[model samples]
Target: MNQPTKKVLSLFSGCGGMDLGFEGGFSVHKANLNPIANFGWIEGPTDSEQVLLKKNRFETVFANDINPDAQTAWTHFFKKSFGYSPTTFRLESVVDIVKRHKAGENILPKNVDVVTGGFPCQDFSLSGKRNGLNSHKDHTGKIIGDEDIPSIETRGQLYCWMKEVIEICQPKVFVAENVKGLVNLGDVKDIIQKDFSATSNDGYLVVSPQVLAAWKFGIPQNRERVIFIGFKRSALTPEALEALSMEDIPKEFDPYPKATHTKPVKKDVPEELSETKLSDILSDLPEPDGVTDLSHRHYSKAKFMGKHCQGQGEISLNGISPTIRAEHHGNIEFRRLNAHNGGKNIKELQAGKPQRRLSLRECARIQTFPDDFEFVIPATGKTRKRWDLSPSQGYKVIGNAVPPFLAYHIARNLEEKWNLFFK
Candidate 1:
């Protein structure tokens, strides 16, 4: 009966990957779980190894990010997995923490209960430059300096400042996220779902914003984003505001998350729900030159601008990678490509293993991050002290994160409908 934790707060929390999927105990890869949703907070070994998971009931307590290598890989992997307190991660700039919490400066945190974000999807990225709300940068991702003048803190309206931090932290669930090309960009997902159902005053209700698909949850990659969520109209429950204002939501009030890995659709699936392949989590990594795990001894020599570029080809250890893009030189792709540029792994080019690229622990294990979460830390003695994160900032905060097993199935579908949608 130890339930009560639920605090959260995140917000563009890069290196924490939706705060390690809402504070769940880590260690993924047993072909990314789901022996038919038997997830009783998982545990160790067997479906062929790895497992663990456990920990949930949320927690984070607050995290931010203007990215100093995402606060040094989220304060060194949350002070080694949840002992946190590196001032609980606040490298500033959610527009200067909402202008220092609107000038009064108690700067947030008071009964928060979930707020999560992903917010800066590079102007609604379709591999960027769509420039939705005309963002020339600001909100600290820089650029706006032509004598500045782009309001509502740009970066395509930072989810309207994550709907003003869910109208000043009144979070009975918030969520946010972006880039499924912000729902085809035209109305910028119906004007950010009508300014997040006019939050605080309109009292919030939101709902219709889905997308998901990180290899349909088991996260082998090919990404996709979109989320949103909302909720707090005086904190739900009138039968969860009529099963979340219906239009389909009644799978026990669906807070979205269902596809626990799919793709091989051929009638009643269940080869442990298929999919999940990029060699089922990098076929037990070992390559990376004498790896003493400085994020697997680093990679990306870059030069392979061919096959109609854009991370120039290669990846497909039996399909599932592609979208891990917070990008870095030659856009980081190949993990083997030599046969005159079309190199399809042919057993790692007859086991010679050369033409590198995807390392930074194979793009943080294809974005499900967790080789004891240490994305490169090499600065050391002789008075030099500077490299706590480089492999180009660990491939840009593991391609701007959020694949902690697709945020642990959206935080285990909101901790399994939080008491049927709040009291």
Candidate 2:
């Protein structure tokens, strides 16, 4: 009478964000902000929110990440929720996993139903050096990085490893997320998709990739990432399969998972009512305490770690945040009060400080991580080296995560549409 849970194997699963969405056992915190200038988190996910993620029908059987701090954060949340450690293996490289399988080892089970990952994006990031190898027909018409792909030195070739896993495990559906820059990075997108669709025995339908904005999918931030959602030809209905080419699939699945929220520019549009803002998410979060020590644990004291040099900067307390970045640490946006305490700015409030940095929990909330998801970064510590990071790694892991809330909609859409194949 009930369907069995579909198994998932995740790669590059930093902190289990994607896997958590697939498992679907947590609920996020929510609240209403009124009177405009509120900077408090009136609500956070309840301690028991994990009990509420059962509205979906999938489970993560295996997950892996290179960062141990990410593993710490990953294990910390699941252990707290499930009362046992999850299957997120650490210290294992995707290259090694693929090699082991090719060398006649069973790194992953052969019966995965769905596979998902947000592979490393640094090489393909337009903001970065864009050092990955690509066709010379790019905007600049020159291959910036001639480094051989499949070379472990650069992360660009890691997609090859991802493809290898998909080829061997042969899941019915596979979804990959990456920066928008990838689609336009000359031959990088073409090479990866061609490799993905090349498998004859268990090939994908190679649906046209769509770049999705997180805000459109209910996330408060204006993050945009390209999504590749492909259905196995044998797993779709006859009519859906009739239009299953790289070009045709987009027509059939047009507006795949239509936006539930929007931010219209016109002040009169009805959709404007649904636009989420930074105030919507963090207004109720506790404001940062004024502390100037960059070494301090809590984001109490904001730091201009590299505001001028790295292009990382601050965010106004009353506005939506820019893209939450991985390496910025506190270099990125920190909320500052407009006027308070006899009209003193955040700088004067904290003994001549300029602004206040957000705490780790607040950052997680910004990443749409449920309050109870539990980033392992300590509230205060002399040194967080035990977790393989300088305490600031919490922000890195949170920023690098796939935002489980967004992944939830993607996974839920697939489960509803493709579970018929599994059943």
Error of 1 at 317 (Å): 2.2
lDDT of 1 at 113: 84
Number of the predicted model whose TM-score against the real structure is largest: 2
Candidate 1 lDDT by residue in tens digits, 145-167: 66766678877887787788888
Off by over 4 Å in 2: 31-54, 83-88, 134-154, 246-255, 271-273, 288-297, 300-302, 305-307, 337-354, 377-390, 419-423
lDDT of each: 0.82, 0.64
What's the CA error at residue 38 for candidate 2, in Å? 26
- Cα error, candidate 1, residue 64 (Å): 4.7
Cα-based lDDT at residue 381, candidate 1? 68
402: Cα error in model 2, Å: 0.9
lDDT of 2 by residue, 1-423 (tens): 886778888888888788787777676644211112212212333353222333467777777877877777877777787554555454577777777788988668768988887877876787877766532222212244545333432466666677777878878878888988888887878777777777566577766678888777656776789887656667666666655543545533442555666567777756444556666666555434553422233553444454355523555444456677786454555555334312223543465544556667666776777766655444346764454334477777878888787787777666666644332
Provide the lDDT at 15 for model 1: 84
Question: TM-score for all predictions?
Answer: 0.35, 0.80
